[model samples]
Target: MLQRLAFILLAGMLGLAALLVLGIGFDRLSKVRQLDRLPITQLNALNDGIYATSGRVASDAGSLTAPYSQDSVVFVRYLLEEEYTNSKGERKVRTLDSGSSATDFSLVDGTGRAVVSLGLQISQVDWQIRQTHRQQNGSRIYTEHSLRAGDLVEILAHFDRSRQRFELPDRVAGLNAIVSHSSLKIEGGKSLLIAGLWISCATGLLAVGLAALLVGLGIHRYWVFVLVMTLGLMAVLWTIGLVQLKKDWQIAADLYGRRSAAVAAAPANPAALADLYAYYLMIERSASQWPDSLLFRMAAPYSFRVPTLPQDAQNRVRNRLAEVQSSRFAEQNWVLFVVAACWLLTGLLIHFALRAIRFKRLVEFIPTSKTTGLAYGISELFGMIEVDDRYPPLLSSVNQQKCVAYQYRIEEKRGSGKKARWVTLDEGGASTVFWLKDALGRVAVNPAGAKLIFPEKKVSHEGKIRRTESWLPPFRSIYCLGMAGIADAEASRLSLQNSADFGMLITTQTEQEVVRGQGALGFLLTGLALATSLLAGTVWLAGAGSLTPLDLLQVSLLVPLTLALITSILHYNGLVFLKNRVDKTRADIATLLQRRHDLWPQLLVTVQTFLAHEQDLQTALRAVRDGQTGASGQPQNIAGQLAHERQVMARLEAYPTLKGNELVQTFVAQMTRNEDELALIRTGYNNAVELYNNQIEQLPDLILAKSFGFSAAPMWQG
Candidate 1:
């Protein structure tokens, strides 16, 4: 049950991650296309909406120095990261420091200059300098990237007149405020650069997701469900966030309407005038809070102390405010939608993590013990790690520790505190096919594609450099689960040419011990998932906000239903993983048998050709010596034929370079290759027959085999 659950969860997680990436990619591609259509305008003729503008970043004496490169720059964002491994044997990259700085700068187009605010969003800044510093710690390394001044840039932002600066309107709160309140602002083309960055980020994420999905989906169908569910949930949540943003816009508009009416009434008394001035000041302070047209008209009448505006003017102002607010509202909803999508993505990751623990438990099911005497097909074999001459061992990269297989990584800290992160500098590993020795005998084991596990390792640090390494030292006990057979030799080994399947693993931990650990982890994940689901359901029930009891009940029921559905899917996937092993075994046996059949005819023809060239005197003597008589005096048996051919070859070897003798050498070469293949086929066929026979003769598996039409296969006798 645990194994099945884990398989399903893994499949689902991988699938969801893939779909999320694809959706992000499509969305990014659309944005990039939109940005591409934007015309680059001169600073003097800059419009209100988001548009591209190219200009030289005005260098100032007050511009700050970029940290790493010491370059003079108007703005810079720096980050430091460090890498470390947690107790669970997983490597984690953490941020150590990060900060950004900016100053007011003027953007100069060929025609004119526009003052731009440095506070505008900058998506991807071209870093003038990126340098790596090797710290004393063996496990960690550091690198830095920064942007400097005097760089040519393309800017995208709405030109705002209030702050007298170009800014990212999306960064501000409220739909009406962003659309009707703030004007386009740019400083070094940062805001439009931000838009380009978002599109690129989406595209990158989508590529990763699609690659992961394609790789995992080939192993199972459960990933398909994962992708569909993750995308569906994200879409639903995004729509909800947009709806909320729209509601906020309506409330803001209503407040603006009431404030506008009071100003137009014209106060007569000092108390009334004081009240009106107080209201005017409040509006002025939060200038971006109201619609653009409304704030402008409100300021003009009140700032100039106009007693009463014309009726036609008031209607015009009101209509213009409504039109501007509607456009802003639409514009603002996209930001909310992105936020909702990001939140749902985070939620899905958490969900996948919870399920991953359960799936990991399935690894414990891989067999670990003495497999020498057992019938082959697929078997788990246990042994101690050893080295062989075929592939020599090498010293580990970081620590110089001698091992048959070693993997190492180096990371550096970038930024400080909450904004810090660890980035990888260099990483690689080397491995070779080695030996696994036990009481049964020494078996040739392939370490390639094996999930290697090592003992606890302490990291060594020297100054800023840190290093961590993992290796399989000689004499360490190991477990391998794969196809086992004794081919052309006495010792039994697995015919593993590539990486093993997930269900079949090669690990250092014992099966029972690993199972116990994975089981504990699975239990914890299950508890967490259940608690989260229940909490979500309770929150829905308690504060559905004006929703009827029936509607609330429907929403509440969905939580458990969804949970149950997920569990069922995982369980079903597990069954598939288990059943596939049996099917694989059958297929392997059939393949070996087919190969033997194909090779036997070729071998026979070669032997016959060699015999036909020979001119022998003892025909009757040979007939009598070998079992030549078939039913009604036909040809000899295959074994008898092979014996006769060997005798002929022995006689011909005496005559060097003869026509028939040359044929004998060719026969010997072909026969040697043919014999090696036959030996492997014979061993695999015999083992498969034994395993199949044993399975059918057993209890539960016997019933399954019978139901599935797993009849006995003939063993090779020749």
Candidate 2:
């Protein structure tokens, strides 16, 4: 049987170990796959375009109108400036001027090549251009431009294909050509296959390791099954990551090669250059919205390189760059890292905890030695003891140790089995102990035990004392006594004679101490909590700084700490206050009881006189109605009865007592209930005050509060 159990446990441990490994593997694979699919290049291209546009705007003039022609035709004129290299490799400048009415423009290159190109009509007298250019150095540029009427123009001379590049302007010297580039295209091969294999192998190994660890430690049976299923899921995710990584790697390599070739083949046509910039600008803009994608990073610069006809386009680009930098994009990365770290730490802690619980091999049980010397008996069975060599009798054990005796009151049914009659026991005395036997002579250890129970108190020569009577119902079958002792025949006889006298004195003293303690503690705690809360609020309110969202979050974090500190201080103060109040109240109650006792004789005498006055009044009224007295005699009798009535009323009204005594039975009861409610209200007020004060003192509110010279509000005392 032991071997089978061991085998089962081992199998479970292995299963759990496999599951943990699989979960970790799956998470890593998912992250890698997400990174692979990111459009980094595209984002990069867009970001660059925004920067370049702003830069160009700062240096260049606004758009201008084309001049009029002699044929009564309105010719819209604009300049396109570009740099190019001749066949001799010398840098040269090219300019192309087009008339709105002209259908063609001619360009002469430095090498005397002449080129003629047909003009395209642009409407709205508004110049809008979008372009894409691939440079020789393997960089792509995308540009977008919009120019209003009356903007300044700088023209670039173009190559004339017919003349074989023969144009030179005074400003053309030393101007270099703008080389263009394009993105590379990738295809499938061996590299992709290798990448996939690596991913699969790594994931499989992780899954297997996790499963083994889980199985090594015992977990719920359901979790073992879950681990098995998780392994398969992890494998599928790993495969997906492998495929994505392969695709991105190929694309990155291809893009690099294509950019180089595009830059080498130069175009002297300014219109073509403008068109290239505009196209790339669009591409870059599209990528900015996808910051996480790898393509955005690669494509972003393309937007920066695009040339603009007007200055405003460059300004727009520069503004975008500033915005991106100002956004604190880098900070977000740090935030993500911190959050992930925290989650990982939490998960690790949970895993360790589970492992600790599962592998707990130590067996612990109650020590039988601790129960030795304690009385062993069913508490309800009264005197009958189940004597065990290892365990002491319950009552006898507590008395000998000077430990408090606890008894549980129980209700047992006679006939109906389900219902029970409530019974109290004196477990310590002989009479109560002797009644524990059942019909068959077996000692009833359960509800049938009618053991006498005693309250805790110091035992004196007088008797085993009762400390206080609890008006509240006894909890379960338990009652407590001060000391542990077995009530044998000798002890029982002596205790019965002196118990009543001993009990009264102890009960009165105990009641006073307990009540006084509670009241004093409550008051002290409430005051302290309130004070600490206010102090914390004041300190926070006094600090200075502009409060951003992050600052607000920091302040919010402090809230719980502040609350905890305040609560602790309050609790301690409350205990002190309650203790003091309880002591004071107890003294007051004792005095009142003493005064009532002293006044009892006088009160009884007054009651007898009042009863006599009532009898005299009845006699007087009967004599007057029967006309049995003379007129003068009747008046004297009436006066005597009236005087007696007044005396009785005066005695009843003149009783010296505490205020509101008629409404309350005892001073202790009145003060306890009243002080308790007051304490509750005070506590609630302090909490509200603390919360409001803290909120106003922190972060965004704190900034506003300081500017206005706002101070922390005081807590309510009531």
What digit string (tens of lDDT, one per residue) describes model 1 on residues 346-436?
3564466445533443444333445355344455677887776754667778787767778887877777666567777888888776677
Displacement of the residue 19 alpha carbon in candidate 2, Å: 21
TM-score of each: 0.39, 0.20
Please write out the lDDT profile of model 2 over residues 620-703, one tens digit for every residue. 333333432212212223334334433533444443442234432243344344333333333323433454465455554465
List candidate 2 stretches off by more than 4 Å: 1-556, 559-573, 576-584, 587-718
Instruction: Write down the lDDT of every candidate, Cα atoms only.
Output: 0.46, 0.30
For candidate 1, what is the total of clashing residue pairs?
56
- Count clashing residue pairs per candidate: 56, 192
TM-score of 2: 0.20
| Count of backbone collisions within predicted model 2 | 192
